[model samples]
Target chain A: MDRSMFVSISYFLTHLGLIFFMYPTDIIASTDEAYWIPITLGIIIHFIFLSIYMKGLSYFPRKNIIMIYLSHGKIIAWIFLLPVAIYLIMIIIITIRSYSEIITIVFLSNTPLWAIMFLLVLVATYLSSRGLDSILRSSLLLAILFLPLTLFVCFVSFQNVDWRYIFPLTTNDFRFITKPSYLMSYFSIGGVFLFIGFIQPLFTYKPKKILYTVLLLVPFWIISVYIPILTFGNSTVPHFYFPFVEAVDSIDINWLMFDRVTVFFLLSLITFIILFLSLILWMFMQIITTCIPKFRPNYLLILISFISFVCCLFIPDWKDVEDLFLINSPFRFFCLLIVPPSLLILGIRSKRKEKLENG
Target chain B: MGNTMIKVFFLLCIVLTSTGCWNNKDINHRLLPAVVGISKNGDKYKLILELPVLESDNMKIQIIKATGKSIADAVDWLSMNMDRGVDLFHVKLIVLDKQFAKQGLTDVMSGLMRSREVAPNAQMAICNEDLDYFFGNVQKSKPPTGDYLLDFFEKDAGWTPNIALTRVWQVYRSLHSSTRDVIIPIIQTGKLTEVEHIGSAVIKNGKMVSQISPNDTLLYNAFDGQGTQGIVEVMDLATVLILSDWKSNKSMIINEKPFMKSQLNLKVTILETKGNPSMDLIKKDLSTLITNRFHRMLTITQKKQADILGLGQTFRTKLPRAKLKNWREKYYPILKLDFQVNVDIQNEGFLKSD
Candidate 1:
């Protein structure tokens, strides 16, 4: 498969899957009646970040972000790459832990948390070890299979929705549009664009194509945030942990073989997160390999997976996992802000230098 | 030798970790209840569970009764006494006695919502008669009729336009949605039939406030924008009209106070009549009849402070965020509704009449 296809698939899975668990809570906490305010603002910021990130990737054609940064200097490279590596690792840890918490809470109440986490990390590590091509191939296959089913579940959930819940749109406080939770939602929605920089070496993609894909996915993010609010109004959204999952659970597909479509929906999400965890694991491994230069890739993979597994075991419960997410927010911002612009400037400068030397 | 050892270790790991399926229960070892009935007994709850036993050429229903302080406790007690583990996953009907519903179902509803075993779409109804008596009578049928209750609520099966179909999720949503309330059908054990649809119990703020007759339920369904087929008998005109299609459009005007406007377009077929009545005359009388009935239902619901028609939803579109806080209590009753009913007579019957 072409590299651009891989980038799109990986990006789509990363953004769509992880947000399924957290976006509803984030949007509800950010705004009172006007969830659309934060959602609209989040999409705008998403596009801006996408353009900057894509422009930076365009500068280093066929070279990943790690390679581009290494060209500047080892010190500059470490400064740029270390935070991203940490951010990726933190995301993997938080996503696996939180989604495991959800699985335990909703489906497998009797299953131990460590067992779920262990199974998740085990699959992700195996997939990560297979390298980028296999990850992309399997991701594409999974996306092809599950994306339509997920959309159908979203469509069926609308049967019980009260559209009036989203009304009185003008009554929003407007100040919440800039709050930290609202800003953090952009990470949930468009933060996947960071992967485009990392995977630039694998394929050459038209910035326009990537931009279109991001635009196409904006409605999905909107649906993810707004559907729960529309189905269960603002008052009820705060009480539930995974409102979207609950919304899906509330759908009744009597004609279908399965009585609870929520199980199917959760299965699709679990598949996506498995791929997402693998993609993040691969990215973290890629960064570690670039920095260390001589470490055996397989050993590094095992070491990182072990560290993640042990850390996951000690993280007592959801409260501690939530605190870890809060702690990682600044690092998340740092990568989202600094990586793209710095790389874009370096890419532009390097191009100018090459032109001068040629001239 | 090393490769074989590695393969053996992998197989061992797979076998060891696959014990995660320990919680899985076999189908034969579980008794899946088809319906659950709850009644308030002092501070405790009396639960009656009905499950069908299928033998060769004959099907019978088994009833289990238990009491505890809460629904879960009652179920736990029942589970302890059962030969097989009791599962509510296949429960299609949940009957709460009207007296129990009147006492508020907030705790019961929350428990049901939180349970993974209960299907969110299970039909919830209010029973007008004692649940024990109803279940006893139901279980007495030659080849038990308990299983028919599921089909009775199904849209394609026994359900008619006159019946209000309320699901567990709808009940939950209404309990949480400030502008919306639920109408659960009230059922009674019938002398001639297995079970009879009495009317509908209007629930507001987690309690039953009023009950509407089945005829009024048709009007309520119409006003609520559910296109249920209904029959309207005009005694003076010596005619019967059947509503084939129903549509309602609701909007609000936000001035000093909110005013709601609901426009109903109903397509009707003249099912039977003693004498021929002009379409124009039938339309006029039908409009008046529906309009009057809807007004009466609305008045009753408003007086009871139950927004069963969900009129507050229309007002919600225009009300600011803060006003919605006490919408059901302070603003909903004061809001005025203007109803416009238009009846379109499509067919007079198999025979065309003037």
Candidate 2:
């Protein structure tokens, strides 16, 4: 089987699952009764943004986003690449810290934070070292196996869901969804890490398969976020730090082998997220390799991993990690708003210039 | 190259072993405590664990009770005796015997919430019966002990509406929050020593003050659909009506005072009716009667200040700025309610007089 197909499929599925896996925790803070508005808002905006991403992808078919910038010549590309590099590093740091905190809270209460971060970083480095193609391929395998399991677990979880909390759909306070800029933060956050670099290589697969990949992702997003809201109610869901994991916690499988589903789901979802973070790092390494050709990709992986491991140590707890993600979300949004459109425009202009030269 | 690979493999093995898996909890040896009943035994508290024991190839039930100043220490006492690891992850039902529930459950509840293993959605109950009999009556057709209890709480029965599915998380929130008090399902075994869900115990400030029967439980859940459904009988002079397919919508309104209006909208697929009545007349009369009864029930809820209807939450949302300082004091007592019953009494089935 071709590895490229795996990466292409994985890239789409992982990107879809990763977005849900990243921020669906916001639904947990939606109290038992007050959870509906943000959930509705999340569903609407996810589709809108997904469409925008597809449109953006359409603009530049066979070129990496950075190369589109470089088409403007070395000067503008260098300026744009500087912020892009910083933003990528910041995202890696936050992902490491967040993953570390999850392990500490759920599975490893006794384990040191640095140890958890180290273990994850080690796996991440190995996956990232395999390059973007392998990372994407692995993601595809992981998604193919896990997405169905996730859906199965979700279907099984419907047994315990009390629909009462969801009724009388009303927004208690708009502040939960909007105030402090949470809506913008929630809509266009985290998943854009995939759109960073090596775009030209990604679309090597057939375009026809891309829609199927995106279609496969819609259920993952809806089930992960909306199911929690439906079960917990808007009032109660927002209180949980990790809503999807909390949704698994609500599973009361009477005679199932495993008593608590939280542990099982967390272990599996964390595996997918680790693959995702690794892909981000691998893609970032690919970008750096583009910049400095002499630096071996393996060395870049180790370098990013070391830096991420060290950064995870600095964060005291999950709250600080959340605060960091919330505060730096604007930077991530800037990447979304700027990177694609800028590259598309540059790609268009470069195309026109080439046509004129050919004429 | 083969030698180097072997050396690396050994090194990886060492590292793997060194990084101990904290979550490696053995299921066979682990004593799974399903429902824990904590009650006051004079000054100290009595902690009861319903453990599933395997003896002579047949599963047996074990009740272990320990007295301690706090819940954690009480569990510590059980830990000393148990041969295996005591895990509460499977602990779904927690019943506080009436004496403990009435005096206060603040201390016991806080401890349950503190444990990381305890599930947030664990169904909590309060009972007036002796904790020992309650334990004896917890027999099930299922082999594993907890499976029977799990099905017991989750079963669709006539009195299930009166049983509040209170989780540890909800208990913690209600205990801390000013908006709403906690309501726990009241379980009482019948004369045959079979477990029966009698009603619900309403707790204010961790103390069980009042109880509501199954019919009133349906009335309460009409606003909040958290519990199971069965037949509800509402009769007038002419005919006896069996109300099935019960569903209701609850809304919070903040006018001069924050009041929650609940519309118990049910598609009354009437199972059986005694009187030979026309469907249209039955619908109209039933609608009016339901409107009156539900209106009275709402008044009663308003009078009791049972904000389980989430009137405080409504005010907190719709009128955030004008939200009362204390929902219990300002809004709950003076709140006005409107009840509208749109009973779509469907055509009679087998019971219809042709």
Candidate 3:
């Protein structure tokens, strides 16, 4: 119940990896100027869901998110758990596949793509198979080992920021809320919030603590979009699939042994992504075993990893990777729609039941 | 203890495999080009890569030339022919032929960016002489000085205000921005020197529409907020070095006609005064000199409707999204640019004050 520190640090680490890659391009694609509007909107929506989900979990003490939903009925479980399960699988595929593609583009051109993907899948599955205690402990280690490097990279990546592109500061248009790129920005904001509701058995975290951690994430959300825009301006930023990587590639700081800071940025984010993938895999396996209740946890993890590797191999190229992500938006929407409010309603109903017994 | 050992072994296996360095090549096996000379070869593109010879103790130079359908193709052909892979990561200079630039650099720049080989900040320049002679004589007679051109344009090294500094990303930005144009410095092969810094080419929509003198480039650099190392010789009065406190204010008005005013404030140190000129006379002379130079430069740009000074960037905020597309044709030619220069003498040199 008292492991809030690990919860918060892992929260920060997971979201840090989410912002650098596709998030910047999506946000910049969503709006021309004053990107802060869309950014804050996405964060606020995710924040509300997080608070509600945590509050609901507080109602059922000692029960994890899976058992809480699965205890009700098969219909309730399918309605609540299926959306998140599918979303987790979709993200697992995209993150590993695209991350391998970026590594190929940045430094590992000679290495075949599947080789990288296989390596990523192997590491994540291994970590998740060790179960929850190992995941938490390893996350604490990875955070301490990698957080400073990530911060330094983020700070120095701002070197080429030219404020002149900060022009046309007031768009006065909220229609960006409807832009596909804007709505899909939930890909960054809501990535880690779902994991919190599932963490009840291992530890308890107040929604306020998670909210404060999210407050720190606002700067990352803003910088991820602004650094590329300020450096390249609106006209050139869209040409980039990964704007932050190109923006950092343009930085020419000598005295450092690393010539391409893009490589440094890529490698650091890769570690974070792998850690994040492991966390996702753990929760993913948690759901699968809960559904059947007959399969061994290790066999389910092996099955999931094997299927993920096969799906990743089937993803032919970058275009398909993008299409698959866009196609998964419906599942993402369902997860957002069904996960929190159901927990909250059921939690209130259960509380009434307990009150009747006591009175 | 046995379980811990097995875990450690597994950890070792994962780290070793995941780094993707399984087929790692040593640094010496890679050839990093310092300068790439891009020119036209009949209907195809010719790229000349200038790399440092790896085995040479004195750092001798080597050149590889190839022609293909495009820049990346030529680079690929060169790499296939060479013993080592050619990485453009360290390529610091890209020299384009003047005739090639006149054909519009939009395609070449977009190609370079798309390939993702060259770093975005790699400096871009135009060569008036044919690249064969430029890369040939320059690398041959120069005794393989090992990227002397990079030192030549590098800001903290031997850079001057008269040399306009343009990068690949800046040109790409200008090509995409509806209202913006850019100035890429022009150079030629020098008999004694590696290359001569001649003014700069005023590019509108990736084609050179006009050219400005070295002194004009100084003002362009100052106005573009690039650097304040401008050393101007004001007729027979004095030679003033513009120091780092350079400031400017731009105001614009739009209605039937577009009008814009830029006020430049400069701090200077007097290097040499002809006949010990008065303080007022020195300030007046410096002001008039830069004023006339910028006026001449502005006239050429306005006639060609090139926004090399980036004045259109200010107007970008004023115009809506749709109108911005026709900024150069509809607004730039009619826009008026006026300059006001104020000089403050920070140091009077070694001599006493007048």
Q: What is the C-alpha lDDT of each candidate?
A: 0.79, 0.64, 0.82
Candidates arranged by DockQ, highest first: 1, 3, 2
Per-candidate count of clashing residue pairs (backbone under 3 Å): 0, 16, 0
Among all windows of 10 consecutive residues in model 3 chain B, the one with the lowest summed lDDT is: B245-254
Residue range B1-354, candidate 3, lDDT tens digits: 644654675688687786657667678778888899988856799888887774637867777788999887887887788787777878899999998888888899887777778888899999989998887776675467776878888887878888998888889888887767889999998756778988899998889878888888888888878767778887898888888646555646567466787788989998887797898898998888888888888888888988888776777567766676777778878877678888898988788966
- Name the docking class for model 2: incorrect
Q: Which ten residues in a row have the lowest lDDT in candidate 1 chain A?
A: A183-192
Candidate 1, number of clashes = 0
> Model 2's DockQ?
0.19
Error of 1 at B294 (Å): 0.9
Return the TM-score for candidate 3, rounded to 2 decimals.
0.95
TM-score of chain A of each: 0.95, 0.84, 0.96
**DockQ-based CAPRI category assigned to the predicted complex of candidate 1:** medium
TM-score of predicted model 2? 0.76
Q: Across residues B1-354, which tens digit of lDDT does each residue of candidate 2 receive?
A: 644553465458448744667656668867778878877888787878887777888787777778887776777777777776666776878878898888887766666655567787788888779987777676442354544665667744223555566777666656655456667888777665356778778776577777776666666665565533445554642443334444443446645654455555666566666556667666677767667656665465556665555556545545433344366666777776666666666545666553
Candidate 2: Cα lDDT at B230: 42
Rank order by lDDT, top first?
3, 1, 2
